[model samples]
Every structure is written in structure tokens, then in C-alpha cells.
Target: MKKILIPIWLLGLAAGCQEAPVEASFAASETAVRFVGAGPAATRTVVEADGTEISVVWGSDDVIGIFGRGATAGNNYPYAAAPERNEPSQCTFASTDMDKIFKWNRGEQAFYAYYPYAEDADAEPNALPVVLPTQQMQNGPGSTEHLAGLGVMKAAPVTRVFSEEDPAPVGFTFRNLFAMVEIRLKMAPGTAVDVPVRRIRLLSEAAPLTIGAGTVDLTAPVADDPLDITDGKKEAVLVFGEQPVLNKTDYQSFWLMLAPGRHPEGTLALEVTAIDNSTCTTTLPAVAFKANCNYRQDAALSLDEFVPAEAFNATAAVTECRVGEPVVFALSGEAETVDFYSGEKFHQWEYADKDRLEYSDVFFSFRAQMQGGAQLHPLTVKVSTDFDGTFEEPNILTAAWTDVTTRFTLPTKPWTANNGPNTLERYLEEGRMISSGEVNLSAYYDEKSPYLYVAFFYHVDKYDATLKNSRPGIWFTDIMAVRAEGDTRIPILSQTKETVHIVNGDKYAEGEAGSDWQGTPYEYNGTTISPLRMWCVNNPPGDRDAYAVTNKLERKVSNFGPDKPESVKGGGNGDAPRLQLRVCGTGNLRNRTGGPEQDAHRRNGNGLPLYGDGKTLRS
Candidate 1:
């Protein structure tokens, strides 16, 4: 629920005059008294600076008489008669004594007035209703200070003098001698429940101002009055009991009149009694009640939604799973394979496999299964940092290569015939069949060599023996990276074709390398194929069984220098290597030869020494 409290000022007239008199009468030319405010109705309106409508009860019973200077107990002349009870809007005053008609001389004059005139004209004739500073007025007969009801005083001094030559009637605007307070209660929006309020009360310690001829002193100090009416009243308490709150937008308004001074500096306690004999109390911050100013306080009640306590289970809430739940995925249809280290483009390492390095201590984890229950093949992971863009002179691979196969590990168990039907359930039962590994390339990381490359080496002998010239499925799923923190795992590859796709091996051919080779076209599958996927041929087909290996795995490069020590780098702590690379794939050999692999024992296009024995090239 939203609650807003805004204070708005009511403009009171300092001086004003009635419309031009139809008859030639001095009384009609006299200034008329009025109040103006922002309320929709005239009676509810108070004085505001920009208001135009006259107060409905200006000269009615609500506001009885007006007295000018020198009009005291000893002299009753120069005063107006009681406001016409029948026509409250009437502004012109009437006097019975013709010799002492109320007249405005050619000079300034001041006046004071009170509401609910005194009935007894003899006892304290000029004493307006007054109360003790700490006494609370209740709505009852004993609360009255005099025959007049609750008193509200206002004093207005007309500074502009009136003259016979002036054609307009003079005007005098009055300002309140007491402070007006209004309390508003509302329900929060979207609240469907109802809160029945039996009663609402506002309690404050207050006292009256000193009223004198043409002046009202609101700042006067309060004095103890033991002789004052002492029934059961203690402090000023305005009680509004049994109000209905029907809907979210329902609201209730209550107004009170208090002495023209700041109340005691303390919370104004508001007690709300519910229909069930229960009560809720809320306090508002201390406020100052300045004379002639309107103070509005708004409160909004919000109801909390109901929730059953019995539905919570303490045991299950704190339980933690030690073993990771297995995720299963499938790969179907043709798998595209691209050669990484062959042609001029491959020597330049211009492919989608290159990426900017962003994490330290990167770990690659996945569950892989070879189709037809074939034994898992050995895989090699390597990293490099010196390969730049020049392919004409220094071959890309000759720059540097670090074999990181020892960083990888095989699963605990191997695949068995008896497994569950679903992918997840089957993988869990045959979890040992999956192979996972980590590559810590922190040593290759440096600001001078901003880019790091990664590659995978599949044994040519194993590919030729198991599946060659055929798309034998090799399923990989749940391929993710663990950064510096063992717990922080970011997904790098997914089994779904849409998330992971093959880099067609033929696309690595010399002239075939286009803009698509530089991390663009492959992005349509949702993930960018890094430029590092350039393929390399270890030995020509004539010398040995040709096998293709994945190449050019580059980490995300940084334009800024290496991260500062003790400062956060990328998404991990800067103390360790901050970069990760993950590659997942399926299917068998789509062998390539020719272009740069014709001469054996010679430096190939990648500038790597070629040997007849597969072991020399593999190492």
C-alpha cells in the first residue's frame, strides 16, 4: 500500500469588500469578511491564496460576529449584529444604533471574531471558549467553555484605509487563530481482505490562545488551571468510532481544531480498535501545528497474504546432494568437421575457434558415449599464446604449443549394456562411461600475448581402426567450464544441435576460408564457433593413416593490460589464470590431405616438423 501526505494551504482574506451597493448606503460600502480554500463544497472550503469562491458559512452561525478597534465591554457600538441566520452568505453587517453605525474612517483598523457566540450576555461577556493546555476536549455538554460551542478564533487587520471617494467596498481577509488538522485513513491497493475498524482516536495535549481586541496571541505559554472544568477530560482526544473499510480504495477522513501553536514534541498516537475487540496502534512523527495552516496526516494499512504453516518440512529444506545429477542429451544426423592447420587461412589461424580469454583455472567437464558400445578413444588438449596473424613467414603452429592432456581424466565407470531407457537415467547408471577433463593454462597467460589458443588431438590410428570415412556417432553432453572457483561452472557446450554444431572439415580448405571462417556464419546456430577450430593433419595419407585434429582454440583477448594483482579479473579472482575453453563434438573422420602435407619430414604449412612415425608428430 502506498501512503502520501501532502500539506495544502488555505488562503484567508487580509481585506475584501462586497459588490457595489445598489442603494446609497455607507454600510454596504464597508469591507466584507470572507474565507476561501480548495475544497469542492463552499462550507468545507478554508482560506487559500489562489481560491476564488467565498466560504459558505462565512457570516453564518459558524462565524458569528466581527468587532473593530475600541469596541470593548464598556462600549458595544462600532460592532455588527449577529450574522443573519437564514442567509449565511450575506456579507453586509447591520447595526441598531443609528448614532454609532459601524464605519471605516480614512485609516487602517483591525478586528477579531469568534465562532458559536455566547448565549449568556452578562457572564464573562467577552470571554471566548478556553481550555487547559493538557485538557482533552470530548464531544459532550460539559466540554463547553461558555454558552457558545467550541470556539474558533480569527483576527484580520485591514491596512488599507477607506475613503468616501473610493467606489469599491473595502475588504478585510481574516486568518485563523487556531490550527486545523485532518486525518485520512486508506487501504492499500490490491488488498482483497477487509479490516473492520471499530474506532479511531487522536490524542494530544493542547491549550487555547489569548484573545484580545484586534489581536489573537497564539504563542502565549500555558498555565495550570485547577479551577478549569475538570470532569473526566485529560488531553485533547478526537474519537471517530466504528468506521467501515469496504475495499482497497476505501478511505475515511476526520478533521479537528486545535490551539494555534506547536503541540508537544512527541508522537501523536492513533489507536484503531477493530470490531473483534482487538486494537492496533500506529504513531505519526512529531509535527508542529502552526496557526492558519492545514496539516493532513494519511495512513495506509496493508494486509499480509495467508500461508499455511503445516506445509513446510524442516528435514528436506536443509538436505544437500553430494553427487551431481546427470544430464543426458542426444546427437542425430550428419556432423560437419573442419580442418584446422592446413591451408594459408589455417596457417593464419583465421577461423571461428579463437575467443577472448576471460576466466582462470578453466575446467572442462562432460559425459561422452561412443556409439555401438565402442571403447572411448584417447584425446589430447593443447594450448599456445605466440600465434599472431602473419601466415606468410612464421607458421602459426611453430609459434608455440603446450600439450595439456595430463590435465584431463577419465570417469570412474565404463558404459555397460544394462542401462536405463531415458538419457539422464541411462547416463547416471552408466556414468563411468563418460570422459571429463580440465586444462589449466595459467602459464601461457600474459598481457603481451593477449590471446591463448586451445586444440584437441584425436589419434589417427584409433579413428582408422574404429570408424573411418563414416559418421559414427560420438555423443557429448553437459559440457561446461569450471573457472578459478571449483563451484562456478559456466556452460560452454550443449548436446542440442541448436546449441552446439560441427565446424565442417572441408571449410578449412585454402580458398574456402571466407568471412564465415572468422567467427560469423557459425553464429546462426546460437553460439559462435571460435576461430581456433582450424584443423591440422599430422601425417599425409600415403605415409600413414591420415587423421584430422581440432585446432585454433583461442581465449577471449583483452585490449587492456593483464588484470592487476589482488584485483578481480574477468569473472574470477586475479590471483590465478583467468580464462576457459571448452569443446564438445561427435562423429568420425572426414579426412583431408594434399595442399600443405605433400612432403614428409618437412615443415608443413603450419611450420610443424612432419615425421613418418605417428608418435613423433603426435608428440
Candidate 2:
């Protein structure tokens, strides 16, 4: 048996329009042709029709495609109510387009009509090319404009006999072609009640929302059976006009239109996306949607466990640099607030392992050997509190450097050579290592500066080929700086490649202490190597045993103990040494007991880790 679904609105067939019951109603007129209601009245008022409350009214620009009997095509004729019809009550419809007027002939004729008139939509009056749009717009509450976009309705055929002197009203038994869904959403028990909802999607694999472009066979027998939506989409989205906030006390209503079908249990769900781009889903029970019927679904949405992935990210240009040099950090992402842990004395992420209240003393240790030159003043240690990160010469010369060279012991003469002066290969071994006792650096620690720079000024006063004052080759190894509080030594710096920025400055002229080195470029085995101010790890250019520069500052044997250096290979491209400052070890830094890390990973909080450049350390 086929269920005859009635229309939810009515159009009065008489001049003095009045409300009628759900059953069929008819009226007759002498001059003008009118449409009567066979199902429900079309008005803006919330009227009970067929045991459902709906408000459907005739708009001012309504049009209908009407087909006369024995004709294959239909004419699109516009219809509207009277000029004074404004209230939510029954009204009559008359032709609005002057050129497309519909008249009856003196014979028995049957007429077929469909709402939402289109010009090219013509078939055998059975297979009308009806397309349901996927994206539906929302106007407001109780506004049928959203439903008007996807709603398709057709009237049952009506037969009448017309004469020149006598005219009668035509009644239509209109029926809807699709099903309706009304969703009522509320906040879950622990969810925030004020989060705004952006969109809601209805998903079901067994029951699709819409079919591809196809013809609707209006001549089908049954109206309640599942519509043929074999090739259709699995999801239908409903966008809200005003992103309404959720409340636990009341429910917000949203409407959607989809194909009429039966959705299997456990395959239907509603996903809601909030304004913050977080999503929440709730399952819907099994349901069978019939044509011309609206199903109301009530569900709760919880946003408590949804954490947006694009919250915050940070990356430093250079992870470790000299103290006076600037630290450039590039930050991105969106957040309500952000905190930057500088890893300085008191601003470290590991607060428990912060620097002591008052440092007892600051000192440095180094191993160096001076070879070739009679003058032992080629190397000096200096400290500055105002040097930027730029490696230019004028910037370095303008900065005030405090001479701290006298605080440490430097090598005075060349180590005992195993062979001649030009072939003294024993300097590359660990036996010639000269240890500089712990030198005080407490006077240069400025409390106002965020960083301090310690530079090793290695320069030759004059390059004399006669060996009178020629630049001596100097090698430094196992260099370290620390802060002492009683017996607790906190490492302030080390010589590692990643911790130092080395520049040879100019490789041409040398006279003043800060001038570019003018050491001659010598050819060695076809490669021209410049031996000027080279801060390299292996031997300097030309392989002269007296002036070959090398360093084992990056030796990995022990923290602060004298160990054999790595076997020295003779090349200028060998890895140079670097030093890092003020490293602290934290046992349980990211404590799960409290703070932002714990709060971010708390219950119902998605455990989103704070993303940053992994090169940065807390201490």
C-alpha cells in the first residue's frame, strides 16, 4: 500500500480566504480561476496540519509550471497573493506575469502543475528533471527560504469542464518529494556552554543524502518506500547563518533536507565543527525517513576534549651564539598567550636548577703551545659586553673589549721538537700540551647584560721570514669556562663547533693589532692555501712545522681532564673547535605534577605537545 503524503501548506480557492481542515476543500468562482487546498493551509502562522506544526506561506514571487491536458510541455506562470495580504493566514493566488496568462477552453481538460517554475524543464509529465542542490542556505528561524532551495513538490492531476459563462476554482493535492531533518543540539555535561558552532554534517554510509543528476519518476506508485539514491553522497552539510553558542539549558534547532531512505543502525552520525576548527561527533540511532515528513533529532556535543593542532610553534635562527650576539627567533601559530623561556640565569624553563643566588667566582682553563716566534704576545683573551652578532670588522673594532689576558697562563716558548725546527712533528701529539691554570673571570660578569662575549685574539705583530718576530703557530685544546659556588662547578661554556662563529676577517694586510693578516699565500701540491689568521683545526697552510696551527678543544675524552688529543691530520678544512656556555642538567624538568605542560596533557585535554625547534634547550 502507498502512503499519500499531504502538502504542509494551503492556497485558498475562494475570494474571502479562510482556514480549512486537513481534508480536501473546494470552492467555485465566476470570473477568476483560483487554487484550493487539498492538504494543509499555506500561511506564516504555526498551524497544526496532519498532526505537525509548520508555517508555510506563499511568497510574492512564487511561480508554478502548469501543463494542460494532451500537451507534452508546461508553461511557467508567476503567481502572487493580493496586494493587501500581509498576515499569516490563508490567501488566494492570481497570475502576476502579464504575458503568461493561463486560460481554459470549452472542454473537459486535466492540468498538471509543479512548484518552482523553470523554463527548460519539460518531459512526458512523468519524468521531470528535478535537481536537488547540495549547499542550502539558512535565512533565520521559522524562515522557509532555506527549505525553498531544495524542496520539490508536484500537484496531483485535476480534471474540470469549463464554459465561457461559468468558471470554477482548481484544487491541487500537492506532495513533497524529499524528507526533512530537524536537529536540536545542546552542550554536553562537561563541555563549555558558550562555544559557537560553525557547521553540522549528517553522515550515513547506508543512506546517502542526495543522488547525482537524474530524473524523478513522479509516476512511481509508492511514496513511503526508499527513494533510489544509489549513486549519492554520504555526507550532507548544513551551514548556520549566525554561529549560535551552545547551552545546556536549551537546544538550538537546525534544519536539513536529504533523500528519503532508511539508515541502518550505528551508521549514522552528526559531526559539528566549532569556530576554533575543533570537531565533535555524536552518533544517531537508526531511522527511516518518509517523504514529506520531518524527523527531529536531539544530541549533545562536547568540545572539552578537542584541542586545535595549530596553536603555537617557534624556531630560532641560531640556537647557540656568543653572549653579546643577538638571538633571533621566528615564531608562528595562534594562541591566547605565549611565554618565552630565555634559558638565561633566572628565566630558564627549569627553575629549580637556576643559577645560584651569588656566584663565588668565574674562571676559564685552556691548553696552548706557542711555536716558531720569539715574541710570545701573539695570543690574548678579551671580553666584551656590547658586540652584536654581525661579523664585520668595524662593528667589532668599535665595541669596548676588556683585556683579561693577564688572568690566564699562556705558553711562552715552543715545545721540545723531536726533529729540526721546520720538521717538528711532535707538537701535534699530547706531550706538548701546555695547561693554563684556572683564571678568574668574575670581574667581567655584567649583571645588566643578557650575554657576554669572550674572544681569543690571535694575531702576529709582524711576519718576519728571518724568524725574528714571525707569527708563531698556536694550538689550543681542552678549553672550558665555569662558575664556582663552593665546590659546585656549573659549566658555563665549552669548545664545540656548533657553539662558535669564526671569521678570518680580511686575508690581505697586517700591521695594527686588528688589521687583516698579510701572511703570504703559498702553493702546496697544486692548491693555493692562504695561511692568514686561519682558525682551523688541522695544520696551517704550507705545512711549516713551526707555524702549523691546530686545536683539540673539541676532544671528547673527559670533561675537564687532560687526555690524549686525536691524531692530527694535515689539512685546513678539518673541523674547527667551538665553545658553549652555561649548561645545566635538570632531572625532572617537565614535571607531570603541575604547570602548563601538565595542564595541556590533563584529562580530556588532547595531550597536544608544545611544538618548537628541537635545537633549543631549557638550561
In order, what lDDT does every prediction score?
Answer: 0.35, 0.50
- Top TM-score hit: 2
Query: With candidate 1 superimposed using the best TM-score fit, by how many Å does residue 555's alpha carbon deviate from the native?
Result: 99
Give the lowest summed-lDDT range of ten residues in model 2: 549-558
Across 545-594, the per-residue lDDT of candidate 2 in tens digits comes to 11111121111111222211111121111122221222221111122112
lDDT score of residue 64 within candidate 2: 62
lDDT of 1 by residue, 1-619 (tens): 1233333323232222111222221222543322111111122212222222223234322433344553211222323423335654334334434654455544554443333233332222233344423223333211212112333433332223445555543332333444445556666678777776544555544433222222223112211121122232222434333345534674565445555443454445554544442344555556655544445576665544211111100011111112122111121111111222221221222222354334345444444444322323444555567655333222434556677767666433323464212233443454434566555555666556535544443322223434341222233444444335345554433333343223333223354321112222233235432221212232213111111122223334433322111111111011222111111111111112212222223232333332211110100
**RMSD for each of the candidates:** 31.9, 23.6
